[model samples]
Target: MKYLVMVQGTQADYEGMRGKPSPGSPAWSEAELAAMYAYMGAISNDLSETGELVDAQGLAEPARTRLVTAGEDGKPVITDGPYSETKELMAGYWVLECESLERVTEIAARVTRCPGPEGITDYPVVIRPILDGAGDI
Candidate 1:
């Protein structure tokens, strides 16, 4: 089955990391940055080696995001970020073709070990099975 792993973060968590400088800055210690990169690299490499990684990517900053709404005339309107009222926002995702949901769960568990820049950790990964046959039409 194909699964999509959604990476989500709370508003407080998102804002906490916002406007931060680049990873290599003096404000970000080398050890911290290395841990983050190493964790991500390891997951990517493992998935690639196993041929389970369909797609994966980190998203750009939320500030660059925009929202579109439809007017009464069915036209679209553009707006800024923070589109939803939920505390958690999706940061990125990975689509994986795994044998079962258990396997996807295992992968999410492994990703949770990755360390953030400030030694903060968020189990932001969510796994859901894809329903390809939902629309028979």
Candidate 2:
């Protein structure tokens, strides 16, 4: 089965990662950021080597994001936003083909171990099965 494992964060978290402290979030040190990168890299590398990794990506800052919805006249309405200081957004994701939910659960466990600055709490990493019978996934 294929699974999407995701990590979420807020704009404040993103700012802190980029060295701009916002409200409750503190700026991350270079070493702390490097450690996070290395930890996530090791997980991705292992998944790739084991033929379990399908795809992975870290999304851009929420400030650059756009929202789209259907207008009353049936046209597309696009606008900036849906990001806030406290609202959580997806920061990164990994698509993995695993033999069982147990295997994917183990992988998600590693994500929770990613190192970061003090006062930074570990956000929950979600895993959901993908419905991909159409071969488009």
lDDT for each residue of candidate 1 in 45-98, tens digit (9 for 90 to 100): 899899999998776546567889898999998888754665556777788999
Per-residue alpha-carbon lDDT of candidate 2 for residues 40-128, written as tens digits (9 for 90 to 100):
99999999999999999998877878989999999999988654543778889999999999999999998998998888857899999
* CA-lDDT, candidates in order: 0.72, 0.89
- TM-score for each candidate, following the candidate numbering: 0.77, 0.91
RMSD of 1: 4.5
**Cα distance off (Å), candidate 1, residue 117:** 4.8
C-alpha lDDT of residue 25 in model 2? 77
